[model samples]
Target chain A: MNTRFILVLLFLFLFMPCPSQAEMGMGISGRTEALVIEQFPYVYEGRFSIHNTSDTACLYVLAVASPYEDVTEWVAVSPAAVEIASNGYADIKYTIAAPGGYTGDYDIRIIANGYALSGEGTTGDRPVSYLQTSGSLRISVNVTHNAGDASLGTTRPHEADAPAAEDPQPVDVGSQAYLDVPTDVSVGTAVRLRGGIIGHEAPASLCIVLSSPMGESYALPTDYTYTFREEGVWTARLTLPDAPLVERQIRVRPVRAAGMAGGAYAVAGGLLLLGFLALHRERKKGQKRREKSEARHQTTLSSISLKSKTLEGREMPKGL
Target chain B: MYQKTRITALIAILALLTIPFVWADSESVSATAGINPYAPSFEYVEITDTELSISSHLDVDREYYLHVHSIDKNGITDIASLVCTLFFAGDGSLSAGATDTRSCYTLTYTYANGTANWTSAPAGHLVEGDCSATPDGYRSRFIFAFSLGKIAIPSGDTNTWKVSVTIMDRSGQTTTYADLPFDVNDYIEWSGVPSTLELSSTCMDPESPWTLPQSQPVQAVVTSNVPVSVLFCGADLMYGADAIACETFTLETVATPAGGTVNTAYAIPGAIPTESVTLVDTAYGTACMLDPTLAGYCNNSAGIASFVIDAATGATVPYVPAGTYSAVWTFTLERGAGVTP
Candidate 1:
């Protein structure tokens, strides 16, 4: 076992001096994640780059698509097809014309299909073969027509989005997904909430509709301080575009003065004073009974003495 | 003869000094204090290509300029601070408030054999390329090489950019390459249309009046150079003496939400003699978005343009004179966003 271990260590040490080799492949290193626009009907200038570190020059064809949108038609690339020299790079440029009227978010995928130059051209056309190698990047197209629509979350470009169900409503959506509201707050304390589309991406401004205790909703006034004046478990409901219905209840606690309530203190003080008066009255009654019993004892003793004196007088006379 | 000998000695000293200057291109630096006056300059042989010209000099209206390069080595090194901080100078047109910002980048290299190496620029610095400088013994001088080739100009910046480059050595001495001006173009175009729409007797129903979709939708391209809108209209369909009025058809993108009635987003105007009606609009005139369920926020992605016939007018398929109705349809592209009232 020692000999085998020694041989393995020697073999690894000998190979450590050699430099590691790289493989022929492709990678993209540019704005692969986002292209968010607002108040469109204007152009959006975008860019990305392709790195083909292969020995032989390869040609790349680019394609943009989305499963649910026509983003491919909305975008155009200057050099949709490019030829990168060996160990070289090709910079790509694309434009997105965000139209007005309708507003929402979209996920656009830019796919680069690469092919070897020498492959096949029997008909003099670029040879089409089985996909040799490819690189792709997903760009989240977050467009809003409203100047100040809050977008709390941008799409995760790398991961595939959860497929939306038909008649997609926020039936199972949590309030935290749409609005960020506190579960607990003190009376007269301002409830600072932020929401439009809630997640990581911080939006500049949010459109809010605060619900009344009576279940009526009103566009929360800009200068409206969201303070809870009274104490109760009040529920506020909010609705967003595409029917994301989220309702959350906040437990509003009454204001405490110096860790105690004034009303409680008043009730406690009144109860203590009533008890003191009742005890004082009871003591007076007991004192009066004691005095009466002492007077009765005095009268009975005097009467007994008089009776005794008479009996003594009679007895004395009899004895004489 | 004594005077001539002194002049010859001076001449010999001068001849010996010119030897290093003559072979300075390939010559190694000596224990000398100063370098060649033109050793690291923009006017050097390898610095031949100075102008980073546009690809299409004739066409002055395209949004992006891909990979503008001056690959000619202009021997200087250690570039710091690459900022892409020029916004629309025309007017603050892009101010939609806070999320209106561009991106920052860095550079990394991978070898032909796949050995990856990181070449860094501080995060948020804009340039994306490899920059290297190796010192060649001289405390005051180092050999520098740059392979930078990218600048994505946004369409809103309509004016020329006057850029200035400054290079500094470790010894605090500097070289200045002044005034490299770059001009960008602005333009917009799109392609790919859907198959034809078919109309028939089965077109009208009071409950769900939308007709069966005939074909694919118009594939709209996104671009930053110019804003656009798609409009559609057709003549009256006539079948063997039977004529159907054009107002009977409607084009819309979104389906009606449950319980609430959904109106067609962009409806076609009256046929032929009637002015064209805008379908794909840039002036957020109609709905909030294309599909709220698909994208969480306010997004305007294009949807299938479905045609619906009006049943509210009391014209059912049986009540109207219907046959194989046909009319020539024409779609037009027009200036949108900025031009819309």
Candidate 2:
């Protein structure tokens, strides 16, 4: 029975939360973990979270410090002393004033020193002893001048270079396919779309669905070329409308081109066809008039031959 | 029961180790201190009151002033004496082979009600003093005038000087303040004809279109003390009054009879009368001549550029007011073709 009791107590010690373990430590966190400031003759205001991680009430002294002596001289901390309740947190404020005509990098750190109150109900001016569980947290602040060049190390790469998502799993849309389309296009300009089936077999039919900036979708013919009249960000999607396959969408930015409008080409083509039809009709009318003239001459020759034959018969009777 | 007692002892030891110990208490004073501000600052003023000319030589006989005073703040606490020293750098030699050097001069002034006594010291040495008297008011002002000849500066050398003023209080606290840079040089000389050009009001009329004079002869002769590879000469039209109506003017170098060349005319599209405008910039013009030897200098005579007022408006607005508009024509002589001396 004693052994069993010891085993049960050990299990309870392992599972139960210990109050003494929670009562003896301090912690500090910053609202602004890192700062990037530009320009001089400027002021920066920051706040930090200071908590008594221990279970007992504690007194804390907050101070603004820096590795750079010049920065330390310019930084000011408010509410330098505070009393935090057990397992409670407090916020401290700090201000940094940068002098004019000085351009360089400045790193600042905010330090909170935790101590044990010497007496109960201790308020201001209470002597405190340093705590063994005191903690130090550092919040890095970077300050620079506007006229100076910004450090390029903090910049991120362009989002366009990110790898494209893998092709969606094939659905019931006939055979799988992929699309090859330009990511950039100009408004009122013709763009070509080229794609083929995933395998050697060609799909029964393939079409393109264009989603415009106005949230409108268009079902375009299978023609490889298309011209967008509107100017904005558009998404060109290649899909098999008859088949149940996933469609591929590509982003495009359409810009307005100079000179003739898209409709101008259609109008010019219509005018050329109209001119050719008019010329062909005029030539057909000239040929019909020539055939009529030839028939009339042939009739005239036949009438002359008939009259000559009658005159010769009359002249032969008179001579007998 | 024995095992439980041992576990309890182990837990107590761990708790004791985690808790911080408090030593014997003793009575002590706990005081909080704040930052203290102390110091008496003053502003400095140059006594010459004129813009320093780079080309004109400084005359050693003329007295120059260095004034320091505090109008807002009180003077140094219980001031006993104020000593002023002027330091000269790059003033030593202009010889073709001499190395540059620096030197300093000191002059101590004794405190009085409104006046002070000056005691000059040898060059490169400081003169120390402790006058018993003090100024009547809390605000203090000191003016020191000294001649450049006393500094032993070599001829034809360019010199830069700065002044440091030190104040000693009764408690022996000494604070020194340094002034801005002041330059003095002796290099180039130039002279112009007609000393001054007066453009009559009749030449500037709203009713009649105006043109520059073609016959009135005006010229300038520029000479340099040292050899220069190229020479740049121009004139700035300094107006006497603020413009009321128009803001356009033109000046052209029409003729150069003394082997000088003329380039495109200088035109001011929108000029402010209160500010000076360059009527001619010969630096980039045909007037600039190259000397391959780098030993030749500018000693040639160039014609004075002609001026036409309110011509750039192109009949868009009325000519400048009928008042007798006066302008000062100041000529500039630079060393290189496009460089300012």
Candidate 3:
């Protein structure tokens, strides 16, 4: 019975969990679970809390690791070592800074390992002996450059429609009569002039006149005789020279001659029209003479008949 | 045999009991760096009306603001110093007594609460400092003003430099961060050339009766550190040589205030007397000269000279083709004129 009891006790001792293993089950928690760091030259800070779930007091060490070895220089974890009472918690801080001109993303891991303090110690300091529980925290830092200008992201509002072109409203320039002269005209070319008597009936003696650049005036015909001798922008006026009290003014631009002359096309068209009319007149005259001859023939035929009848009557019967 | 078995079992049990104690005694506590999920980010460097403060890259003749942070878990009480050094390519070291090798910095310790100010050193060096902490953590801030005017590079050339930062805590723990590379470049530059030159229009009709001499302005702009001259060569629509001379066009140079020195030189052979002048310069300067006789140098003062191409009746204008022509203006800069790389 004694041997059996001893064996049972030994089995129980071998199967029992280790003190460090029990402490290792404790969890480490952080106020900031994940981190995203900006590119170098920018500072990033993070905070974490380690919870000692087990009844045993624990000592912990903080270690940081990254695939980017250069990050170690820019990053730091404070309170590299810590002591916490059983079922108590402690806070850890880490700061990372990106070097100037550094940009991109980085993945870093922070690990907290808890060790069960064997002997009783105060909260201030304790001798760390064995590994108990370990927990890991993950963070990401993305570094970027700030935009130089704020106006770049803003959009301009849509614009309203533009105003329409101004109408050509006529203005009274203290004139009794005025000519509607074209704004553009060719030098040495005839241009039509249209006029209306303002505030009165048509002036009987009104005649259109054109003045050259040299101040030389020439009277124009009713049909088409207004001409300019020089190439320039000139003004035309409807003059009532006999009635000097009427005041009127008109202006037009007579530009230099461009391309082919307009008169050539006009002359060619007129000649074609005259030829067509003359041909039609000749055909009508010939038809009228033919009709007159036919009528005379008919008249002659009647006279002959009448003569024959008279002879017959005079000559008497079959003997004549 | 029974006694030996019992003894073996007892030793095994003893070893098992001691195993837990040994493991517990050896394990040590450790803390890991944590991550912050919500971090601020920007896409470009910040610029202010008065200055350019931050940038992702370095440019020659531009200012940049560099900020660094130092944090300690134990709560930073005092900082011994902070220093930054720059190393160029091809040996990774700055020359002895080179003032541009290192730039000092100023430190500002901001507690987690966000209230902060800075203490600056007369030079670029950073000295001992202290920091305060809030509910967040303890932090030391370092700021530096950096520029790239210390080095000379060729046009269209780029060079890389490495920067390193070293910091020390009051406890004598020295930490260094290094291997940050920056690129510097020089851009190619040229000035005083007009975007386009327009010539006079000619009548399409060969039988046009109205004939008076028609002329158009021809000008050349010169901006150079070295003596330079310009030659205007004309060709027909098919690039036929001697088209301007065959057309009997003349080039007359007109001196203006913008044109520091003016002369006329004729490069075309078998051309009639058209006023042309040429000049020589003993020093570097810009010279505008019109020479229909020969291609020669003008005075050495930077300026622009105006010229007129006289078009006679039935004669083609210089640099103007019958329909469309190409004008080739050759600009030559003298060698060894003190142009810096």
Candidate 4:
């Protein structure tokens, strides 16, 4: 038995290079080479590359841990980490817990182990990692703090804007301003408004919110009011309402509107009167000229007939 | 008399209203009936043939000239400008050159097997050809060689081209030559790298901020005249204890995000890496979600995620498998500490 054992030992020594080759042959590299974590005061995760370097195929196991104590209070344990495989390499991913008040620098590292197993009767070779020769991967963590706040304030300019503000009734002392009709009425018969206009030319329209005393409300047409350019000349006129309103207690607000009927009538009457007087005056002058011409013609004709009669009488006496 | 007087007054009023009396009579007359509407017309060439045939091994250091001339509706012959593009077929190669002549181009070639030649020269007479060998099809192709000065076109300009030869017959007939085939690749050299980039990530969140870790950064840069956008980046993550989670960050090619903005991403289909690596530790009942503040975590969720293709590059650098992973991944997208939600 001793002689056979010696012979076996010699054989083993001669072919021992195969085992070394197999050990170096089986290996794997992680697929991912980079990661970005951006949650502040929260847990961050990263992945490491695992490459298979040995000739014999083998499974890989990966582990991650905190390389720095001061940077983080919590460390990444077993369940929180993951290992994956592709092409001969496995990836070991690590997640760090959220350190709410944590700031500054911290190092994260990942370690991978590769192993090859054979036979049903015997266990496999012990798993090993390329940590020492291949070197471990480390990541830099930067925790930032929040600064102060900056804001913008409201300082807007104020010009003239009606309706947005309260709509107040304009007051005039002397000139009459048109007031909106209390009741709605059709065209032809003008309903009088009670407000006064302070300018000479009436404006086109004004806005009035009218509501029925019974709770019903309607926005009066803004086109119903008129505006005047001149200052301090107030006047009011009756207006033709668009439609008839059944309610008598309709709330009416005075708004400026153009004079509807009075100015039009005055203009028409003045033009008609001036035209008639001029025509009559022209006809009279024509008649006087005709009369003078007729009188002159009659005078001339009478003088000629009288001379002819005198001549005839003188001739008759001479013949006798 | 009264009627005539009234008539005269009515006519005067009508004439006053109709005539533009404010303008001088000479100016008004000239403005109203100035030009003759039935004027003589002329014709022009609208389009040109976009195809050409040259030697695949053609030397790009030399100049090549192509000429095209068209006849108008009145049978007046006029020169036409042809803008052509040259491409290679098998091992695709392209090169472009400059020329000194009115209708010639000096071809520069960078790609090996084939050549592409075109001109950026002034307009000149275009050579017209009849491809009667081919039928009345959209494909019109012909091969011709002419020497103006010492510009010699090699013999094998046949196989690698699709020429679009338009002919303006002497009778003022305009025809379009489309999809013509060619024998050789005209040599042209294009310098400088691509001007765009494509960026992709397995997991991403728009609401959360993102940062690339110094260790696993997915960055490809172009140092020279080449634009970085032409570069493509792809990433994969293995799920489980070391669950794979990767984020790809790409710089916006455009200077501003809101101005003449450029797109910077392309989403690759079925290329997302989302497997979970886990220890299956049922005994320890701890459900650890991916930390938003962690590096490489696309999200705290447990599914495989892939990034869309970057608008800049068309490459997917690292690709991973897809599935629900048992492993936990933590990513932290924390903004400033006091950042409001």
Candidate 5:
């Protein structure tokens, strides 16, 4: 019976939580958990969540022993990972850069250093006590290439509407695009300028500007301009002048014009009114001339008849 | 029955005699070398700087050659060498695809007076680096990394150093040594930091000293406007206690800067301060020096050292060792923005 009693006392001593001896009741509290992460082929980044579940406020930190000398103790926990304040609970997260193609494993221990108080009746008026605990978790990760929706070139399920062309967005250039011009054009050779807005289908007219290498500028007419109606493709052709063909710079701008049809209507209307007035005057003159001619013919006929009466009927029928 | 008893008694005695010998020899660090009794030949040695620290590795092969281009704060590799060991003093030099035991040789880096021979000597390859502040801003210091080829020291006797090292030049005659200190079979790692760098003599033990798991602080007045935090700091391994262990230290910014950043450099304090050197090959009677101080000199002269030879002969027979050597080195500052208060 004595041996059994001794055994019970030993068990209690080993398992019982230790209490803080300081008057301020400041001591360690909460539990610590370990994260065992496997390495990846490329740079691998991940975050570890540190949950605080203590009655009193506490601070938690992570300590790592690296083979590298550059790594040191008390590496400041990233502020973005966790929130810590006086007398408050928070979670700490760490975005750690795993060693490239790491074939080995390491231990990361979380230290929970804080203080709290026990219930008034729990420990013979010693209400304040420090609590500390720890747990560990292992992650065996296999490095892999995950071709998700974005990687497969499929639009995200909840993507917003694409922005307009005027927005200052960076666009990827095609491999075939180049800015090469002839050093010496046999004057009058038509050179082409190609520029385009990506992902848009519209007839785009680019204004081409030619400048000499010596900073001299001259304006070229756009009378022979052509537009590209295909999306993401703009081309403009221009005949080079005899001078400044060698080492010249060319620039193109897109032009958008509004209210261009109103002037054409006014000119067509005025031409139609003029044609109507000329036709009306010609009709009136023709009518008056026809009446006069008819009257004269009738009078001649009458005279001929009277004469015929005198000369008897001999030439009268013939003359009539 | 009498014959059987006698055989059993004889067997028991033999077993008793062998037991003590086996136990005595079991606890030795050295092995009765397996197939080839001699140490393996080093084909080459490569040095590189990783995100963690600077390290060196040895390649076990037949032939090796390395060129050291430059050395600065980044890492040092300005002097390279192509070492060849004439086994038995030309008894069994390396030939095309020969796999005979007689052709094999060994080399090592011997230690004495608390420092290794290659490390303490003045004329040997000495690559240094430093980071300093300039008017422009923080910039990385330059360092040279190198790879060199197969040359082993003949390992017939204990007195003969088992190392044959040769410093190959672009034009000058090659510097060759047949016997050297330190075992060629074992590799050495050299690295350091500028402030308060210590070479621990205990590092002669390969396994114990190679990895520095402890941290040492630099004793310098805070010069920067801000409470300067040293991000990446390194130094060349000092002789004596610290032999062959490269140490790197990094610190984060806990407080703000309070002063201007200071330029920190790691150099052999007692080295001669001449800026240029000229190497003369005796047979050709031609003198070549990449001297920046002289007219029509090369611009980026870092490791240009002069060695006056009696004569320059295209043949190895006419080769004589010139005593003096020099190299071009540059110092620059790093992390100015972090240093600003």
Candidate 6:
């Protein structure tokens, strides 16, 4: 009888409604696990079809997880998180471009994390007290860096290492212009807009210009000098005759006021403390002098006050 | 007198025969058209807006939806066909059939309208929209319902879906229009893995003695499908005095939410917030980046929230007893407008 009842319980559990039986909240439709890119300054295009096998709508977020920081800079994907209807799917488009100088093969794994929250908005009651983030889908990207190819494209300015374009439009551009100027500086101060052009050079003259809405303007020379006569948002451009190779926005701030608004109160508090200390010291000094005089008079004329009067070289003092 | 009456009867019969032809070719948003059908029966102007919705599906369905509004329904009688083309757009625009359009969207088609059933679009094709115009509105302001499902999607295709509804008038003049830029994807991955939350003394810089160590905030990337807010389940996870009070925990924005309607009422502003004490003790947990874009999976620049737990309690992180702390979290789905799994 006991055995029969146990078997019946097992049967019921097996057929019970199990939401977990479906495909996990999120899944990748593509069969392949690895992605291969042919060249350096390499630009790779691929797709990730996220399938929501569960009965509920799910959200998935993609993030790059690799030891190499360069891999993160190489990839660009659109629409951060996707919410697909039950059994429905959506595609994730990605563009991967490696820098110019990198060579050899490196492994990169991009993770797609799925989320479904139990709590409603800011006002609703939640089943749990906090949000738990888990469940991930990964794509192992294997990038091979051979020689340079203008066709492959790059994620960053290749001038530091490689070039991306062919001519005016070249892939893996090896030429780069860098500006080493601070973003905020005061007026009347000479701010040297220090920068350089690296990698391949254009056939035209390299120059830098500071432009602002105000009348202040400067087409910099080899010294890279710029004297800010006014305060405003200034645009710094590194131009190579035809186009501005690199541009940096700087805030030229006017000199600050003499004293700080908030700090002034603290300064006043310190001054009051010093005045109290000085007054206290003076009182103590006066008390000591009177005490000394009192002790001396106590041995002679006890009735005499500390204040004494001397006339014709004769000191006179009594009860009066 | 008998001859005159007979002539009038003959003229009446002739007039009736020509009137039916003129009425059949009447041109108006509500009228039947085209005794002479033009090159295109329908005129297309510009797209107003689109949203991904479930109301578009009739019998079976698609993911993205285009609610097409025609300024004038004139000359258009019936929806001829829906051509869902999938292609590798090397160029940016998803034109009707540019030189670079790939041919794999629909393998078998009779190339005509209605009584037609697709064998089902192949796997990677992005769209197969079903849109039809009804005479419910006034002559010039008819709303044509356009529905798109993901029967097809090509890889690395961004904004490559061009869902044009083929509209025809009574005279059989046809026109097709609607370019839908949806960020749908099959291949996807995150820009980075969940960052390691390191709040111990090791993270502290030895060179700077006074500086405290701050752990990055734990975050949830909110979706646009609904008004989303993060619920820190074990509020006790912070207040429990196992070792250190979780008050030093902070919310950080790793990426900004793309095109999300800021719920000015639902969230606290600022890209990064420094309110750990108020969050730990308060009823509402700390909100990461609350950009609910009514949501996509892989755009790194799109917007991601990083929830950090820093050991830096103000200028100095309180001393914590050395030990390993672990937590098991279950990420569930918040389905519907604001419904949860």
Best by lDDT: 2
Stretches of candidate 2 off by over 4 Å are: A1-320, B1-39, B49-58, B71-77, B91-102, B112-115, B123-137, B150-159, B187-341
State the lDDT of candidate 5 residue by residue for B157-261, as single tens digits: 121222345543223334454442222111011011121122122233333313223332221111111111122211222211222211122221222222222
lDDT (Cα atoms) of all candidates against the true structure: 0.39, 0.42, 0.40, 0.28, 0.25, 0.39
- Write candidate 4's Cα lDDT for B1-341 as tens digits: 99999999999998898777655566556645574322112222112222343322322222233323333332222212123333222112222223222112222111113322222222222222321111123222222222121111111212132223344332333454333333221111111111111122333432232232221211211111000112121222222222233333222222211111122222222222221111111110111121112333221112111112222233322333432211111110000011000
Report the C-alpha lDDT of model 1 over A1-320, residue by residue, as the tens digit. Answer: 45754664565455443322112244453433455576555577766666664455556666655544334567776576677766566778887765532345666656554443322111111110111233444566666545223332233332333334321111112211233355556778876553432222323333456654556555552223488766666654344332323334566676664124324444554565466556767877888999999999999999999999988777565456
Each candidate's interface RMSD (Å, one decimal) is 21.6, 39.3, 43.0, 30.4, 29.6, 16.3
Q: Model 4 TM-score?
A: 0.19
Worst 10 residues of 3 chain B by lDDT: B41-50
lDDT of 4 by residue, A50-96 (tens): 44333334333333434333222344524221222222434355566
Candidates ranked by lDDT: 2, 3, 1, 6, 4, 5
Candidate 5: deviation at residue A68, Å?
38
Question: What's the TM-score of each model vs. the native?
Answer: 0.28, 0.20, 0.22, 0.19, 0.15, 0.28
TM-score of 3: 0.22
| lDDT (Cα, tens digit) per residue for candidate 6, span B1-341 | 89989999988888899888777764732646566434333333322223533321111122333344433344223333334443322234434443121212332222244443332254322233433334434322223332223222322222233344444444455455544333333221122223123333444332222323344445543322211222121122221123232333333323334322322321432222211111211111111122112122222223343334433545343444332322212232211111110
RMSD to the hidden true structure, all candidates: 29.0, 42.3, 45.1, 47.1, 43.2, 24.1
How well does candidate 4 score on lDDT at residue A174?
11
Candidate that would win on TM-score? 1
Model 5 chain A scores worst on lDDT over the 10 consecutive residues at A119-128
Model 5 TM-score (B-chain only) = 0.16
* Candidate 6 chain B, poorest ten consecutive residues by summed lDDT: B276-285
DockQ per candidate: 0.01, 0.00, 0.00, 0.00, 0.00, 0.05
- Misplaced by over 4 Å in model 5 are A1-157, A161-170, A173-184, A188-209, A217-320, B1-341
Better of 2 and 3 by lDDT: 2
**Full candidate order by TM-score, most accurate first:** 1, 6, 3, 2, 4, 5
